[model samples]
Target chain A: MSFEISVSRRLGQGVIALDMAGGDGITALFGPSGAGKTSILNMVAGLLRPDRGRVAVAGRTLFDGDAGIDLAPERRGAGYVFQDGRLFPHRRVRANLLYGARLATPEARATGLDIALDEVVAFLGIGHLLDRWPRTLSGGEAQRVAIGRALLACPRFLLMDEPLASLDAARRDDIMAVIERVRDEFGLPTLYVSHDRAEVERLATRIVAMPQRDTA
Target chain B: MSSFLALTPDDWEIIRLSLKVSLVAVALTMPIAFGLAWVLARLRFPGKLLLDGLVHLPLVVPPVVTGWLLLLAFGANGPAGRWFADWLGIEFMFRWTGAALAAAVMALPLMVRAMRLSIEAVDPRLEGAARTLGATRWRSFLTITLPLSLPGVLAGAVLGFARSIGEFGATITFVSNIPGETRTLPIAIYSALQVPGGEEAVTRLAIISVLLSLGALIASEALSRRAGAGRGGHVL
Candidate 1:
């Protein structure tokens, strides 16, 4: 088991809960629009605090409500690829891609798990866009750079939230190929969140459907 | 008018002192203003409203009242003044330093407001993105937030500098008009007005003051435009 999540949170007037333990591959949290799929990913990334639960990824306890142990987002080392790419507008593409490497701790750097910049750049096919600013990139190019950035962070696990929701069909195919290579080559455990059943079927090794909530 | 325009050595000294005091005051106030603005823009806590009000109080209250408050806290025998004197051997009582301090207080509100608006314009989500990429909060702020808000910071500095140069009531009240020390441009103009046959000198000094303020205003405008352009033409 590479991921364990049993968490409940109060969102507005309702409660959202999830309980799952999955293998060391891409486990997709498949659900409808308001079923709290993104919320689960947020909890795993340490962005949203769970009201009560435990989140362990790859033998590391990221959050334990009973033990009063909740790590900060930076300490969690979860590479989160947001829906909008969220690239730094002020940084050039090269700087954006290298941001994670620049921020890695000395101990993490010494561990030899650090992904090479050239290899990732070549793998993602983003070498041509390196000098350009984020504002100048197309949706597909920006998403590719965003993925490269997350990989360079040396994350313990991956949390992706609807990363292809905005791209057109052609761009989606390109990014889908990239995600496939990242999963096969990097071998990092991933918690993928999406509403598109086709995307989940194609990429996910196992599917965990979100529990239905009372909309009334 | 021509004779009046011919600046005397005393007038030159006053202009030089004014420039020095305002520059030092802005340089000192900028980092403090940016810190406060960030707190107000990004943090949510109890008494935030009270803190915001306190920072803007100088802009609303009479400058004389601000000077009086400064005197009570930073006087020679006051706590901050006494500590500085004991440890750093620096004094603020009736010195040019006191004048600069008064100007800084008056300029704080403008500087903080400008910086706060710019900081608020940056999406908090970007910082979150940086954090998930192994960046500590401080690193994200320095790398993402600071660079994005550079224009506003520069504009705030210029605005504060303009305000500092025009400072009069607080300066006159805190540090008496000491010649060659605290007698900045505005104070010199006031002093010249009291003497007979000093109208020409006053006119010249007033014109110079106006020109300096106009220059600062134009520079801030240019910086704001650049800020908008850099942010993909978003009207900041």
Candidate 2:
């Protein structure tokens, strides 16, 4: 899917403006912490509303300030994975993976659970962890499960917020491989947040750099 | 000893009435406590400070004063009580229902505080994750927020139950100690202490009170531990 997001939001005294467009591939938002990388992803996920701008995903207007159109997060069709895997602690791995698929509209669910499950399981190699509790999984394993859970949602775009940040060096390398495989196989447009330049070089098809805000 | 051992018909009535009032109070207050706790922990809106203060008022105010206020608002000739009598043929003054109302008021703060802390501890990022996965606000709350806060909810319920079981001043002031209708375990104990021959009976009731409170605390601890274990052996 192709989309463009041009938005401006106030941060403290200054405004953080974002203008970007890309087709189907991983677009890395590279910046140090507090450089508004996560803010851009939040806007894309409909978690934060832009002060003035438009967001369109695959020709669908998600937000348009003049038209007064703002779709809620759920309606945006973007799967989001947080820095910490936000797996439901009470639910088992299978339940967490199936949550989004179950809640999807009938037409969306028509893709079939088995197909989605098989694809995500193979893509992220989380088949073994299906029955285990989220807490039992290692950091890398948990991140794979989180990614698989998002894939089951069958999102138009995947928004990853520093998904590899919590893992150790070796674990980050392993999980990044799984992420790259999923992105290529699914052919889904992804907005990846990261501070690591090597990660961006290895995974991103395009890069958007954000710098720290200056204090006067 | 014989008197304490004998479970008289009136004693049975007091036992049943106490359970009835406490159960009703706990049931009625759970949803309200959950809502108030969520708002306090998650939302930033105008009047939030006032709402926070109001929810905590029962904790700080004397229970007797709270009962007095309820009596003024729901007494026979009072606005709400009069309307209830005229329109619904219901009365709260000196009734078991009034005892339940007082218990609910007294337990509200404990419930809200436990739930608020739990809700606050939940990762907002998780909710954001659910939102991206096509969950509406209410659905996310039902499936995600509510489940994650289960330990807190259980803790709140247990605390409320303990508070309700031991409630005395407000309950006595609002509903009085009608032996078969409004008298609860605590009231029974208090009454027994006032009589010359009721010393043993008071001891029995006191023992029962202690046992029940201890049981509730143990149950809460066990529940929290189980929940934490389910989340991968990390205690919340």
Candidate 3:
């Protein structure tokens, strides 16, 4: 199992709960809007604390509420590609791509696990955007840069939250191909959140259906 | 134009002293003001409202009252003043240092307000993204929050510098006007008004003061507009 998550939390008069054991490839959380799909991603990334649960990725326990083991987000090593491509507006594309890799652990570097800046940039086809700022890029280009940034971190697993939700149909195909490449080439276990069933069916090796809870 | 060009040596000395005092005052208070602004902008504790009110007190109260409070707290014989005198051997009784301190106190509220507004405008989500990218909280703040709020910080510093240049009441009350040591532009202008045949000097000093203040205000306004633009052109 690449991802073993069993968590539940109360949010604004509603409860969100999930129990999933994912495979080594891509695991998609298939659900409609407001089904706490994004919340599950947040919990796995250590951004949101689960009320009572355990989250173990790649045999490393990131959060275990019963055991009182909750790591910080930076220490968890989750390559989170946000839905909105939250790139640093102050930095250029080159800097954004190298940000996480620059802070990678010395052990990770010595073990040859860190991704090179040039390789990720070339892989994402963002070489021409090296000197450009985040605000100057198109939505698709920005999302690619965001993906490159996460990949360069060389995270143990990737957590993508609706990475193509904002792109047009053409742009979505472009990102979908990138995701497929990441899955096949990099071989990194991924937990992808998406409301679109067709997109999940095309990419996810195993799909976990998220049930919507009615709020009183 | 000839008369304006022919400023006396004393006039130049007053201008130099004013610049020195204001610059030192701003340099000393900027980091302190930024820290206070960050606290005011990001944190919420039991006494946050009281702390905010206390920081803004100097802005609302009379300058003389602020000066008097400073004298009571930091005077030569006062507890803090005595502690510093004994240990640090620093005195603010009647020195230019006292003038600078008074000016810093008077200018702090404006600096804090400007910095707080900009710091508040920074998106916390960006910091979260940075943290998730393996950057620690402090690192994220330094790289993301600090850089994003640069314009506001510059605006605050310029505004503080302008306020310090015009500082008069608190400086005079805390540290008496000494010719080259403590007499700033405003104090010098006041002195020139009381002397016979000193109208030329007074007018020249007053005009200089107005020009300096107006230039600073314009620069601050421009910087604040840039700050808004930095936030993806969102007006706060």
- How big is the positional error of residue A198 in model 1, measured in Å on the Cα after superposition? 2.1
lDDT for position A9 in model 1: 92
Error of 2 at B171 (Å): 1.7
Writing each residue's lDDT as its tens digit, candidate 1 over B122-147 gives 89999889888888889889888999
Evaluate fnat for each of the predicted models and list the values in order: 0.91, 0.87, 0.84
TM-scores of the candidates are 0.92, 0.92, 0.93
Error of 1 at A3 (Å): 1.4
Pick by TM-score: which candidate is best?
3
Regions of model 3 farther than 4 Å from truth: A110-113, A213-216, B230-236
Q: What is the lDDT of candidate 3?
A: 0.90
- lDDT string for model 3 (B1-236, tens) is 89765778998899999999999999999999999999999988899999899998999999999989889988987898898889988899888889999999999999999999999999888998898888999999999999999998889999999999999999998898899999999999888888998889998889889999999888888888898884542212
lDDT tens digits, residue span A67-162, model 1: 999998988888889899999998899999889888888765653247889999999998999999999999999999999999888787788899
**Candidate 2, after superposition: displacement of residue A168 in Å?**
2.6
In model 2 chain A, which range of ten residues has the least summed lDDT? A107-116
Each prediction's DockQ? 0.82, 0.80, 0.82
In CAPRI terms, where does candidate 1 land?
A: high
Going through the candidates in order, state the TM-score of chain A alone for each one.
Answer: 0.96, 0.91, 0.97
What lDDT does candidate 1 reach at residue B94? Answer: 74
